[model samples]
Target: MAGGLNLGNHDIGVLAETTVPGSVRPGETISERPVDITLTMPELLRESTVTLLGGQAAEGASTDAAITLTTGGQTSTVAIPNLSSPRTDIPQQAGSPWLIPATGTVPAITVPAYAADSVALGMPKDFSIDATIHTKTTTLPAELTCGGPESLDLGSIPVSGDPVTEPTTGPTTPPTDGPTTPPTDGPTAEPTDGPTAEPTAEPTDEPGTIPVELVGSDIVAPGDTLTFSFADEWIAKKVSFELRSKPIDLGTRTVSVSGEASVRIPTDAPEGSHTVRVLSSSGELIASVPIEIEAADASDVDDTDDDYWSDDVLASAGGPGAGIAVLGGVLLLAGVAVMTLRRRAGRS
Candidate 1:
């Protein structure tokens, strides 16, 4: 172990245990014990007259944000320095030795290190390595500090009472029931003023006219006159009668007490059911009756049809002149026989 008092080109001061010598077995073996090294330095040292010419130190902290370092009753507040610069050299004041003994027994010796919950350097390892070579990377304060002036004494202060709210006259209580009557301030309706409309008269049916219906039997002979009676013929004159397309104007006549009327069926009218309509002067249908005419018998009229002489009839009759001659010969024979009888009677 070599203790160095470095202040020249290397550093202001450095103490390291470069190697440790001991006996070991021939085979590869792990050492279970850690070698402890003690480091000592003066409390103060003079600045070197040999001017150290090199790159400048890293810039100070970019932020004024205060950081707290606390160890037991001591606490310190400081701003974290900027780490972007190429150099970081913090000369530590020599005081108590921060003894970093290797933890327990290990397979091999490792560099001793010190860590505490109260202290942390924000600078990264590469930043510290790139920093200007110095005796120490971190500086130790004379004592630990924290917070603004009196932050550590916060727990001593008593919790204050709940804030008292002042009373006010503003309306906060809800009404027990809603307001009663409807508001009368709304607009009023105005009455309409214009011409009064006249009431229309109801239509009345004309008197002296009534619904008429024809009543009669269903059958009528060929030349027979068809009689039809009205059921409700009310006061009308000159009702024109129609049988199919033929019209029989019953000129001007009042309805009889029996309300009966007659129209003749023509002899030549084809026998079938004929619709008879009685229309009033106003062209309104007063009555309708269906009359069926019986078919005329064939023998009812003179048979003017002659029998047609076919060839067979003519042959049976010996034609025309032969039949006439045969009739004449018979007549002559009958006359001669009468004369012979008369002669015979006379002789007797």
Candidate 2:
């Protein structure tokens, strides 16, 4: 049988001895006595226990013993618990010895080895085992180095402790030579007489006027042509056109004495009452008209009529009857002349 046993730090040994009584011839009258065997480890003489088995008490005998071996204080004993048939081959028992402490101290049991039986028996190995212990400590001083000069000495330096002298009566006072100086009187200020007058703002003159008229009294539709005529003579420098209802400024254009200005109504203008104002360059109010710009529809038709007339024509037509009065005066003069001639003839 092939087996192994595990042992501790204590020493151990196996001893075997054979003793026979008065020996007799073999196969004749004979008496054979069983031999006693003991296993010991002297280094484990302290309080330790050991278990033994598988070895025969006598070779070629039918007797065997299993014993628990213990040692204490230079003495050891073996107690046989069971018996079995003996054999020449020894079957090893696998166990570990108890750790014994120093002579007077209690034995300290170390942690079991992590190696398997095959490793412990010197089989081929691939790995290693390691144990480690760690410790840490810290120390601090009562006072710390804050890093600066501690004290300043102004030795043998003269310092005045007396109260500062102040001027009892003077126009101006002097300053002191300490951290807080005496407040001196400021310079005397001259007084003013009365409230000053403010400049007045001049009035602005109003701008010149420009007369305008719409072509018709009806609403103007989108894509419809609008004719703007001047009621008075046109002056290019003084007149400007603006869509007052909208923020559009249709630039000014010069026209003839009896001419008209035509502009296409913008398509984006809203369909509602809109006002167009003619303003002077000086921003004076001149003339304005509220025109209705209608939306395009099937019923909307383009109508043209004599909606505007020239001021020159109107003034000429409304003048006094000069020709008729002139003819009446000539006929009266002729009647008077004929009467005078007839009287002269009668007298002749």
Candidate 3:
């Protein structure tokens, strides 16, 4: 927001107004931009907003002005264009102030960072916010820093707080009410003739480097192809595929000279975390890639479905209900027999 007490000369430019959340996380800043020599070194400044006020620009003009920003000891200038939308509806008469909104965006400035943190923000007031003409008072602050809520709800971020220690477990006590004396009535046991040797631990095979690189999407529906390329030992060799968790063999394919291969995820593949294992010709396991087969879409099912009385079904069943379907022929035989009897009666 910007209005004027005839700020006829003063320009705007509140320094280092706000901070954006770090690209990956949130943090804190000193925010109180002091007048002392406080442009700290070795920090990152970004996403700062500096607003200018009271400057007059011709409406609908296609002109741009220069704004300089210095940060991390490097200086850069950006062009600020005139606002396309300015409030013209404000009454230009006396007693009313001309409140023009601050418009136009400046690219992320690589300015000096504050508070000695490498990624902190700092402000250098090299530009002018005061009017060259005349104004009763400076309406805006000359310096501002990005400071606010010092923490994030993402677990706990150690912004300005001290580290906390973990709690230790307490000791447990033994049960009472039982006799403390040991029972001596048990039979003596004989020692085994052999010193029971500790069983040799089976050597576990560490995962080998999968020379393969996935070519396409790992997440796919059944019937979609999974493509990947490989190098080294697996090149130009037959590699069998396996769908882990379900133990479905996904067939085998010979790697091309280009070390690439593709396999279709069967339409019957289950919707879950599935591993596509690559194996060598001798059936040694190679690297495995994870894939997700989504549930088959019900809408993809064919609308022309067959039922019990369908032509194909009835033909396969030898007719609807089999022998019971010959009732029509039996009825025709009865009619013929009835007609013969009627003719004999007529003759009589």
Q: Clashing residue pairs, candidate 1? A: 6-12, 75-144, 75-145, 75-146, 76-144, 76-145, 76-146, 87-131
Candidate 1 per-residue lDDT, tens place, 1-348, comes to 001111111111111121222211212122333222121212221111011212112211111222233333444443222212222332333343222111112234211122122222111111011111222232111100001211122111111223334477867986658567667786676655864675558646566644554455667665555555555433213355677646544322223334554555666676777777777768888767777878866676434322212223436768756543332221100111101000011100
lDDT of 1 at 173: 82
> Which consecutive 10 residues in model 1 have the weakest lDDT in total?
339-348
- Tens digit of per-residue lDDT, candidate 2, span 211-247: 6777775487765656676755442123556665766
Q: Please identify model 3 stretches exceeding 4 Å from their true place.
A: 1-210, 298-348
Off by over 4 Å in 2: 1-210, 235-238, 298-348
**Please, what are the lDDT tens digits per residue for candidate 3 over residues 229-293?**
88755543557788888688876665644567666777777787889888887888877889888
Q: Mark the regions of model 1 whose C-alpha exceeds 4 Å error after superposition.
A: 1-215, 232-236, 245-253, 297-348
Candidate with best TM-score: 3
- TM-score versus the correct structure, for each prediction: 0.23, 0.24, 0.27
**Which pairs clash in model 3?**
9-131, 10-131, 12-53, 71-111, 71-112, 72-112
- Candidates' RMSD to native: 71.1, 66.1, 35.5
